[model samples]
Target chain A: MVWLLVLIPLLLAVAAVLIPSGRLRPWLVPFGGLIQVVLVVFAISSENVSGFQGWLLLDPLGKLVLLFISVLFFICSLYVPGYLSLRAERPTRLFCACLLSMLGMMTLMTLSHHLGLMWVAMEATTLASAPLLLFNSSTRSLEATWKYLLIGSVGIALALLGSFFLAYASLYEGLESTLQFDDLIKLAPHLSKPWLHAAFVLLLVGYGTKMGLAPMHTWKPDAYGEAPGLVGALLAGGVTSCAFLAILRFYSLCVASGEAAFAREIFIFSGILSMVVAAVFMIRQRDFKRMLAYSSVEHMGILVLGIGVGGLATYGALLHLLTNGLTKGVLFLSAGNIHRAFGSKLTDDVRGAIRRVPMSGALFLAGFLAITGSPPFGPFISEFTILNGAIGSGKFVVAALFLLLLAIVFVGMGSTVLRVTQGTPSTPATATDFRESPRFVIPILLFLGMSLLLGLYIPPQLESLLKNAALFVENGV
Target chain B: MYQLIDPILVAVLLLNFAALGASQLRTVIHAIALQGVLLGVLVVVAHNEFTIWAVLMACAAITLKGIFIPRLLFHAIREVSIRREVEPIIGFIASLLLGGLGTALAVLFSNTLPIAQEHVGSLIVPAALSTTLTGFLILTTRVKAITQVVGYLVLENGIFIFGMLLVEAMPFLVEIGVLLDLFVAIFVMGIIINRISREFSTVSTRNLSSLKE
Candidate 1:
């Protein structure tokens, strides 16, 4: 079942490349995404924990990340066909192939137990997603693609170096050096502290680059702004989660070595710094897609901050992962629809999205509410829980600062969203032709509904999963 | 004789200095190739029995890094007709000085770590780190895209040397995967650079300032 989860997407990627018809190729995404989800269910239900030797295994954390990526991919896949149709030209087979290949690589990143294999998978994702970001082939997209490639490659290379440091750390413990996560955890306490510290820093920077954590997230805006919306959704939601999971694995090692406090400090600094940076940039952001990018930065900050706060915050952080992923899915898809509707992403050109494409505009508005942590929505609930966790842990100053940043982000994002969604149609040409298709709006609605449902009620099974995953982070099991 | 390779690592450090001082693309490429050759020698001399497979791989790396990539870059540069990486964001002298300071820092910092192995030489880690820093300096300071790629190659070489310290930890397949990924990434960047030159008529990243906030 585990092999099937990994192999199915790889097969689809190959098929996407081999198939000549552009129209027929995109269907491979949804088909593969569904199959992956089904396989995840089967894997979770089975009693076996160990599988695939040194290469792949479905531990609790991996299972959680896999479940998140699978569901997120499935939601974003539903939005792809409609999003592709909006392109004036026929979709290239390359786009479909790269997207599926990225899907495969992200799945592999989630499932791989070996740190080396995980790095390879992460690098493969950078290669796979670069072309997708180049879908428009505009000069700006080219620039974005270059920045994404250079920054992502450098980050992953650092990660590889970090992996080596980690392996070397094992030597100090009298253990045969290996890249397997379990082996490393068993040897964690005995490993040299200096090398472990260096390893954690490198790993944080490397994976944090992928996660679009601040200071390392210069590429997120350009890449997310220019990529097709479905691609943005997958990247912001699926790929970033996988990278966070990688960081969480290393954090687990730090905890095992009794360096949890050190790890927590770094996480807190980076996380809060990300949030503050995101808030600052989001205030003046002009492009809608760019706004979404800053939101990604802010959410990544919250995710890490949740873990950094530890205790109940870990569970809240895990819950925020689900909410953030779903909310991004809704926003990116709806933003795609609105961008298509207005024939522009510039704040100056787009107006009265509600009057034009009512379904997309309304969902975009709802997505905005949810993303900014407005009440009665999923993000609000998750964000509140994280804040409560912070307060409960006697982090009064941190909690205060977090709330301040969140409020600033909410205002910055809300104003921009309102400006785009509420006004009368400013562009006469776009308004006359604007209409919401069910294909686009339905996916947005589904994602929004799922996010809202999670807010209203946490399913007992998922709560258990989140708690178990948190335990894995708190203890090194 | 095996200890003779220790001094050659100093050549790798000097090559980075030459790269930092280089204003012309041609000189920079040559310097990078020299570093690559020095690394190939280090790899061969550092290993105990010099198996045929290891020798062949080193030869291939040397040929690719030393010859083919530089040649391809030169061809791209000539075709684009850009003469020099003129007016770097940081001046040449400052970059070289920074490169020297970076080397000093690397040496100072690396000595603090408890490294178990002695045969690998104390200089390998620092040389690799300084080269990596110099590569980053060139990458950030220079405007020309080809020079930036050369800088990236130097950085990769630095990382490669660092990885050598843990050669035991790296499986053969994983090492190959890393190399293959680097090759493909550079190839893709090369294609993009060609496109940038064709579209914008210059390989400088300054022309890419159009997308900013």
Candidate 2:
């Protein structure tokens, strides 16, 4: 059953490539996405689903991430036919194939219980997502794709070394070395402390690079800015969530080994550093898409900060994982529509977006509010939960810093969002014929609605799942 | 293990320095390819006993890293019609000096990490670290897109050298997956390099600077 989740998407990808018509290829995405959501629903409800000799399994943590990715991908998939139709001049074969393969790889990454298999899956996701970044085929998009491939590959390579270090940590203790997550956790306490520490640093930098954490986050802005909005949404929402899940897996190993304190300090430092970096860049940003990238960096920081604070914060981080992902879906898709409607993504030329495209414009403004931690939006609840956890854990300075950064990001991002959404068009007519359509508008609306609902209420099943995931990370269930 | 592995590891380390000091992209690419071949040999010799798995991995590593990827890069450079000589942000002399310093640092760093009893006295860990550091140096310092890819290869080689310490621990499927990913990554990079040259009229990353904050 678990294998089917991975196999189905891959097969769909093959089907996408084999089918010739550009018009038909786009529909396969939503079909694959729908299948993914259904499979995830079943997988989550079942007990102890394992695949490939138990190299892949859905734990509580995996389930949360898998569910978020499925739902996000499905929503974004709904926007694909509309998006491809708008860009009918460009080829859809590569775009369709890469998107589906990326979904397959993200699923594999989430389900991977073995660290090596997980690394392979993670690297595959980078490869799979690279071509999607190149969909625009412009010089800038080319540059973005180049940087993404290089930086992502190098980061993932370091992650491989880190995985080796982890395996060696066990070997150094004279134990039969294995990268099975369960075995690593069981052997956690006895593993060599120095190697374990080194492995964590390497893995942190490695996976952190993937998650667009600061310093290594140099690739995020360019990739997100140049990639199509749908790709940006998936990259920000689906791919980063998988990487965050990878980090959580390791964080769990550290907890099992009683090194959570050591790990938490680094997480606190990195989490704060990422947020500060994102906040600094978000201020007066010209490119709305790039601004969204910075916002992603900031949110990634918050997620890690929540985890760093631990206890209730871990739960907050887990919940933020889902909220931030869905909210990004809304932000990027609507922003994409604005870019298309105006034939520009820069504020100088993209004014009066609301006048240009009413539905997406309002959705864009609403997404900005939701993402900036405004009440009645998902991020507010999750961000507040994290702050509460920080304060509850007695980290007053971190709590203060968290609030300060969020406020800064809100103001900085708000100015950009408002400028794009509120003003009159600089020119009455733009180059693109793009306008508000149900296919494009509805997905963003759906994502935004989910974000709002999450903010207002937590379904009982989701609440329990979040609690189990939080506990799983803290105590290594 | 030490007698056979040490020489190959040492050659691999020297190639790291060669790649750092070399100005010609062709020389750098060859240095990387040679290092790949050497690491391929290291995979076989690092083990105490010969096994079919080691041979298969070595073949895949050599064919992909040594033969196939270099050919692809060579084709890219030719098609892009770029200069063979690469301009480094850091001078050759400085990069060579840094490479030497890195080798020393790597040795010191390896001494800090506890080695297993069976792997005692092997040069694999230090060699891996220095090669990785050298790759980072070249990757960061070089201006040309092709040279940067070469740097990434060096970086991956360093990690592969480190992998030799626990060869048996890595499953065959994962090993193949890693190689397949490296192949596909370079392949995609090759296409992007061509596109970059076509769009910007140069393979140097200097032309890729428009998207900065």
Candidate 3:
């Protein structure tokens, strides 16, 4: 059953490539997305979904990430047909094929129970997404794609080496070396401590690079700023979350091995560092899309910070994953609309977006507020929970620092958001004929609606699932 | 069989330096391809027994890294009309010095991690680390897009050398996946380099700087 999750998208990806019509190729994306969402829904509801001789299994953590990726892909898919039709001059063959393959690879990453398998799936996602970044075929987009591919590949290479180190840790102990996640956790204590520590650092840096954490996040602004809004949202939201899941897998091993203290300190430090970096770059930012990229860096910081704080904070981090991913979708999709309507991503040329395309403009404002942790939004609840968890754990310094950075990000991000949303348009909307069509407008609304819904209420099942995942990570089930 | 490993490993390390020092793009790619072939040979020699899995992995590595990938890159250069010179950001002497420094550091660094008893005397760990670092130096110091790709391949070679230590532990599927991913990455990168040259009328990364903050 779990194999189908990966297989369906892969098959659809082949069909997307074979299909002759440029118009019809893109529909495969939404079709593949819908099937994935359905499969994930069933996988979530059912128990013990395992396949491929136990190589793939949808665990609690996997379930949450799978849900986010599938639903996010679905919503993004709804806008694809509309988005592609607008650019009829360009062929959709590569774009559609890559998107579906990426979905398949992401699904495989989540379902992978073995570490090597996870690394492969993660690398596949990077390869699959590179072409998507070059969709515009502009010089700037080409540059962005190059940076993303090279940096991402180097980071993943480190991760591959790290996996080898992990296997060697056991091999050094004269035990049968294996990389099955469950087996590693079982053998954690007996594995060489130095090797484990080294492995953890490499994995963090490698996966963290993919997650767009600080010091390694140089590619984020460029890639996110140059890529289309939909691609940016997926990279920021979907692909980044899968990378986080990879980190969590290793972190869970550290916890099981009783090396939580060592791992936790590093997490807290890097997490705080990422937020500070985001805050610095976001201030006085001319490009609104680039500012959102920084904003993503900030939220990724928050997620890791929550995990580092532990206990209730881990749960907060888990919840923040969902909230942040969905909120980014809202921002990117609406931001895409605004970018199209205004024909520019810079603040100087993109003012009074609210007037130019009222519906997308308002959604953009709401998304900005939600992402900054304004009340009545999903991010507010999640961010506050992380704060409460930090305070509860008596990590007063981390809590204070978290709040300070959040405030700085809010203020920095707010100035640019307002500049884009407020004031009169410096140039008229004649630059691009893109208007607020229902196809594009509806998905952004649905994403915003989901973010709002998640804030107001945590349905019983979701709360339990989040709790189970948090517990599963805190102490192995 | 194990006694022959060190000499070949040392050759691989020398190729790393050769790649670092070579200013010509053709020489650098050839040096990397030779390194890839040596690593592929090292794959079979590193293991105690010549198992089918080891043989298969070695063949694949040689074919993809040594022949197919280099052929693709050469075609890219030929088609795109890229100049032969690497056009490095730093001088060749400095890059060679850095490669030397990186090799020393890798040797020093590998001593900290305890190797298994059988593998303790082997130079695999140190050689792997040094190759990876050299790859990094090339990747960072080189300005041409093609040179950067060569750097990336070298970096991957370093990891592949490291993987030879655990050839038995890693599944065949993953090994193939890694090779396939590397092939596709270079293939995709080759296409992008072609486009970069066509669009900008030059393949130099100086043209790629307009997307900055």
Model 3 misplaced regions, further than 4 Å? B171-193
> How much DockQ does model 2 earn?
0.59
Higher-ranked by DockQ: 1 or 3: 3
The alpha-carbon deviation from the true structure for residue A199 of candidate 3, after best TM-score superposition, in angstroms, is 0.6
Models 1 onward score TM values of 0.96, 0.98, 0.97
Per-residue lDDT tens digits for candidate 1, residues A1-477, read 567777788889889889877777778888888888888878876766555685788888887888888888887888777667666384467777787888889988988988878888898888888878878877888888888888887788778778777877876555776778888888888989998999899999989999999999999998999888888999999889989999999999999999999999999999999999999999967899999999999999999999999998998898899999999999998898888788799889888989888888889999999988987788888899899999999999889999999889989998899989998988885354546778888778889999999889989878878888889888978
lDDT for each candidate structure: 0.82, 0.88, 0.87
Tell me the alpha-carbon RMSD of every candidate: 1.9, 1.5, 1.6
DockQ of each: 0.50, 0.59, 0.60
Question: For residues A1-477, could you state the per-residue lDDT of candidate 2 as single tens digits?
Answer: 679999999999999999988889999999999999999999999988997787988999999899889999999999999989877788788789899999999999999998878888988898889889888898899889888988887888888888888888998898876779998899999999999999999999999999999989999999999999999999999889988999999999999999999999999999999999999999999999999999999999988888999988888889899899999999999999989888889999888888889999999999999999999988899999989988887899999988988889989998988899887889766477776879989999899999999999999999999999998999888
Q: How far off is residue B59 in model 1, in Å? A: 3.0
Q: What is the TM-score of chain A alone in each candidate?
A: 0.97, 0.99, 0.99
What is residue A365's positional error in candidate 2, in angstroms? 0.8
lDDT of 3 by residue, A221-241 (tens): 999998899999899999999
- Displacement of residue A366 (Cα, Å) in model 1 is 0.6
Check candidate 3 and list the clashing pairs: none
